[model samples]
Every structure is written in structure tokens, then in C-alpha cells.
Target: MTDRLKLMQGNEAVAEAALAAGARFFAGYPITPSTEIAEIMAARLPAAGGRFIQMEDEIAGISAVIGASLAGQKAFTATSGPGFSLMQENLGFAAMVEAPCVVVNVQRLGPGTGIPTAPGQGDVMQARWGTHGDHPAVAFCPGSVREAYDLTIQAFNAAERLRTPVILLLDEIVAHMREGVHLPPPDELVIIDRPRPAGPPGSIGAAPAYRPGKGEVPAIPDFGTGYRFHVTGLVHDETGLPVNDSRVADGLIRRLHRKIELARREITFTRACRLEDAQVAVIAYGSAARSARQAVREARERGVQAGFLQLQTIWPFPAEEVANLSRRVPQLIVAEMNLGQLEAEVRRAVSGKAEVIPLTSGGGRLFTPEEILGAICTAPGGRLKKVVHQ
Candidate 1:
């Protein structure tokens, strides 16, 4: 018999996943819809020989996690909309310094505490471009409670493997709702360790200890490993030293981008339901994916050829897969919590090959199955009619 399990809130699952992923340090401040993550982390991390600290604010929370990560411990932090916004500058710093860490944002209503307890997907675009500069970051979204566990592990692995900050984007509904989740055996899951320095301890010239080779992600040495290096936010060369030379700046920027971009194939993940013979496809991510799946199922029940493309990896935008599906489907509806954030990217990928419809909601509210069904039915040239839920 298959080993299947019981109910778990998304936040609790996140805590469990972090422990399983070897996260040794967590620092976060409590905020609605995301407080459970911090609470569970605080309670469970100690039992797993880990540490948890509740900082004064989100800024201090992220700063502490960065410090812990630099010390060679897997570190993480959790927050919601307003708190996530506070961590932006530090998140940018982590990206610039190529620190390995994870940040979980259980998205709530946005734009200055719009709704504390309600759910919202308004942070979709913020996850991508909230931080300043050209640094690369990866954000993953999980639709189910089980995925909350799986993807949290994936988020930490991606952070350590790529030597960058990874964001796990969860919505209020999924974060608060309880569902069955199977805890995978340790051996069954693949965990990624950060790249380590290959050269001798004292063999360093001018290059930084953490700087990697061309087209490669460098291993970051632990803080007290007798290897001395500098970490800075300014654009720097291999030595992590601020440089004014145009060629050095150019090389550093290109290499920073190339390392992550080249790893795109490893970073992208998606789920397709009933798309093999569908005339219409629905693209959704995060919590919205759950309702989209229901809408697709209902349409299919009525003999409509409808399917769903659920994104697990939101950043790096699975363009190829989406574009391919667009070619096969006549109509594509992009559903999100925001008013056309990922939808814009979907449009670009489809390139007018299919009719792209955007279904959005704000202020921490998620799209209902009825709303999604209506959007699908009213799509131009689609066979769907407005779905009325009583």
C-alpha cells in the first residue's frame, strides 16, 4: 500500500519541510496569514537542533538570517505582505552578495496592510522585481499543503545549490487551510549542498573566496573556515571588492546573471492537467491554481476541452512550456491574485498565438471556482458561459 497521510496546514508543513531540508536557523517577525510559519518554526526548530529568533521587525529578521547563512548554516525567515516589503533592501543585498538562504512569504492583502487575515495574491510581481538592481532570484509557489512541504525543501535546495536567496510564495488560503500531506522519507528526497572551494586555504590572490569559475556557481566558505573574504552590496569583481573599471564591472554582472540564467533548466517546474486534448488552457500559480484546477475539471465534465498549467516555479517564467501549450490550445486564461502580473508574461510567451484572458483579484481575496469558471466561459471564442453559483 502507498504511504499516504493526514491533514496539515500549509504553515505547519513549511516548518516541517524546513527541518527536513536542514534549515538550522530561522529569524522572523510575526504577521497575519504568515504567523503560523514562524510559530511552528519557533516550536519545532529547537527539537531538531536548530535555532529560531523572533526579531524586532522584518528588516532585522532577514538581516539575522543573512548573518546566519553567511556563517554556513541553512537559514530562513517567514513574512507576509508588509513584512515582505520591509525585507526588500536586505533581500537585494543577499542577491548581490550571493548568499544562500530562503524566505517564505505567505501572501496576504497588500499595499500597506490592506487586510491582515484575508488572503491575496497581490505580491506576485513584488516577488520578481521588489528588490532593486539586476540580481537574479528564484520564487516558487505551491498549490497544495503537500506541495507546501515539497516545495519548501526545493526552495532551500535551490538557495544552497545556486548560492542565492530563494523565495517560497504561499497565499493565505493555502497557508491557513488544512489538507493531507505525506512526509517523505529522508532518503527519497534529494538535498543539494552548496558548492565548496576547490583551491587551497591560502591560495587566494585578489579574488574573493566565494567567487566561482566561469558559468559556474562558486562554493561559499563558512564564516570561520580560516578563509578570509569580503561581502558587499556594491557591484564588485571576483575579489568582492568594489571596482570602477568598466571591463571588470561588465564581466562581474554578466557572470552573476549567466550562472543563474544557465541554470534555468533546473529551476523551472510546472504541472499540466488534462491538456493533451484540450482546446483551452488555464495558466495559474500559487493558491489561484487550486481554484483553476476545479474550474478546468468542471468544464471537462461538461465536455469542454479545458486544461490547466500550474506553475510551481513562478520566476524564470517557464516560457517555453507555456508557449508550447499556447500553440496547442486556442484560448489561454491567465489567473492570478494580482491584476495582470504573470498574465503579462503569459501574453508575451503566447505572442498572440492564443487568446489570453486575465482573471485577477486584489486586497487579499482569491478567485473563487465560480469566478474562474465564468472567466473561462466568457473567453472569446470559448464554449463556456457564465457559471452561476448558488
Candidate 2:
């Protein structure tokens, strides 16, 4: 039920979606699988009255995004593994300063540039803990081309709404695959902009810069708008002044984490298929979920009670739902491109409630439905002993 339908690669969908979400500034370096996002933004941003800068490297790229966001522009950047690693310093800064920006990591097989063109979910844990300190984070994982577009927009929205850096974690397969998708009309889609400070820019506002009045998110005063504010990576007070007092630093950390904790219900995303009466469950995300979904179908055909859960939001781990699902089934099978990143988290959540099995690969290709189905069939006897231990 849409007028506009086009066959677009996942990167193309993400670029357009970011623009639609009002991303006016993009700073990124060229990296495989994610370079198309920068290319499209370079050509498209200017036409939409936005700015696009090709930074010297990944570190500079994310640094520019944080600078732009501080100046009151909705900004984003895209990069693959090695580049994503370089951005970790600024990523920590963006979180500390509460800069509302989006970072897209189209993951490739990597510790240090393992395979540029091949897909991998090895960045699952990195996206959550790559940065140095404890800070709030919201990361989205998409499974399909259309989902890439939707989740990209969600990344921007979450950044603005939460007043923190958000991540769109994609695999190379989703970034390169092309599919025709019918999108909803503009009016039907919901958009959220960054909150503006109620107090005058130059005046001593009643509330401090980082203090939230009603919602957990603080109102932002644009940099050029005469707002007297200080931004720093060090722990800061509500007034934006760096503090050495452990009490003040403790409060700031608590607030930073509490905001995300309170919003967990609004952030956790998962899709369950035929899990109502499943004897075994398949847990996966990104491209891995595609195979898991198909395996569920094939297993059902073979008279197996199997189901699949596609995780859309990777961080703030969907613990409650995962725990419930573990209680529902006798076993849970985790599938991913990496050896086992998400599997460890799921295993921790399940906590012996079910026999956890891992169907993983580090060879840059996606796991087959056959592999997932085999796990489901042999789940009872626990024949697959390759569980990822913490």
C-alpha cells in the first residue's frame, strides 16, 4: 500500500532514511560495505541543504559528527570494522557530552580488518563496550534491506530523543543486498526532533544545561545560540562544569544509566515467529536471523516445533523477554556470523533454563538454514556441544 517502490541496496536505504530523519550533517571515511552510505550522502545531502564531509580518517569522521551535533545539527557517520575501532575515542566523548548523533557500523569480519567485503557480526560486543567509560547506548540491528531503512531512521530518532549517541549495527550482507521495498508515506511515519532548552541562551537558566526537567532527557541549547555551556569528556555536573567530586560523578553516572534503563520498554525490539508452542527456539539477529527464520519454516515442515526470535535492538539486551522465551522452550539455538557474541549474552539470560546451542561461523559467510534445523532436531540429546562459554 504505497506509491513509491524501488529496488535499493541496504546502504542506499539507510542514507535516504537518515536524510528523511533530518540528518543535516554527515562525516565519514570510505570503508567497504559502508562506503555507499557516504557516497549517497555526499550527493544527496547538499541537494537537501545539508553538509557532507569526507574526513581524513575514521577518528576524525566521528569527531566531526560530535562537533556538528554540539552545534545543533542532526549528524551521523558510517564505517566498517577497522574504522569503527578508530572512532571509539570520540564515541566515548559523544556519550559523555550527550551529543545526539548516529553512527552506522556495517560490520565486516574483523579483529583488525579480517575481511573487508565479507559479512560478520563480530562487532556485537564492541558496539556496546568499545567506548572507554560507562555511558548510555542504544544500538539497532537490522536483518533486511527494508529493515535497514527503518532502523536507520530509528537510530536518528533514538539519538534525538535520548540525547545520546546511537548506533546502527549492520552486516555486510544487509548493506549490499538489493530488494524492492514499499515504504509508508511521510505523514504516516513518526518523527522526533531534539528537545530545545526553555531558558534563554545567554541568561542564567533556572535549570542547568544537562538537567532534565520532566523527561529523562535534558534540553539542548544550540551552540551558536548564545548558550553559555561547557562540553567535556570528563565527568560533569548538571551545570556542565567538570567535577572531581566522587558524589557528583556518581550522580552523573547514575543519571546516564537510569535514562536508558527507564526507557528499556521503549527500546527493546524483537520479532517472534511461531514461538507460542515451540519446543526449541532460534535466537539471531541481522542476516543470521534470515536463515533462522527459514530454518524454523523447514523444521516445521519436518514436524519439529521450532521457532525464531529476530532481535532488532542489540543493546540493553532484551533480558526479560529472552528469559521468558528460555522458560518457554527446552532449548535455544543462537546463530551468528561470528564465533559467538550475542550467544554469550543470551546464554547468561537463559541461565540454565534451557540447553543453549551455538551455530556460529567466523568464515565471513552466513549460516545456512540447514545448520539451524540440524541444531533444532538434535537439541534434546544435547549432541551439539559447542556452547560458547563466558
**Superposed Cα deviation of residue 26, candidate 1 (Å):** 0.5
Give the whole-model CA lDDT for all candidates, comma-separated.
Answer: 0.86, 0.87
- Candidate 1 local distance difference test against the native: 0.86
RMSD of 2: 4.7
lDDT tens string, model 1, 1-390? 977677799999898888888998999899988898888888888888889999999999999999999889999999999999999999999988888999999988777878788888888788899998876769999998988999999999889988889999998898999987678888898898787676656774324665675446777677777777778888776667787888977776677778889889888989998998887888998888989999999988876778899999998788899999988998998888877888889989999998888887764577788888888777764584567899
Supply candidate 1's per-residue lDDT for 62: 97
Best by TM-score: 2
In model 2, the number of clashes is 0
Model 1 ranges off by over 4 Å: 1-4, 203-208, 384-390
Q: Please provide the root mean square deviation of candidate 1 (C-alpha atoms, Å).
A: 3.6
> TM-score per candidate, in order?
0.94, 0.95
- What is the overall TM-score of model 1 with all chains considered together? 0.94
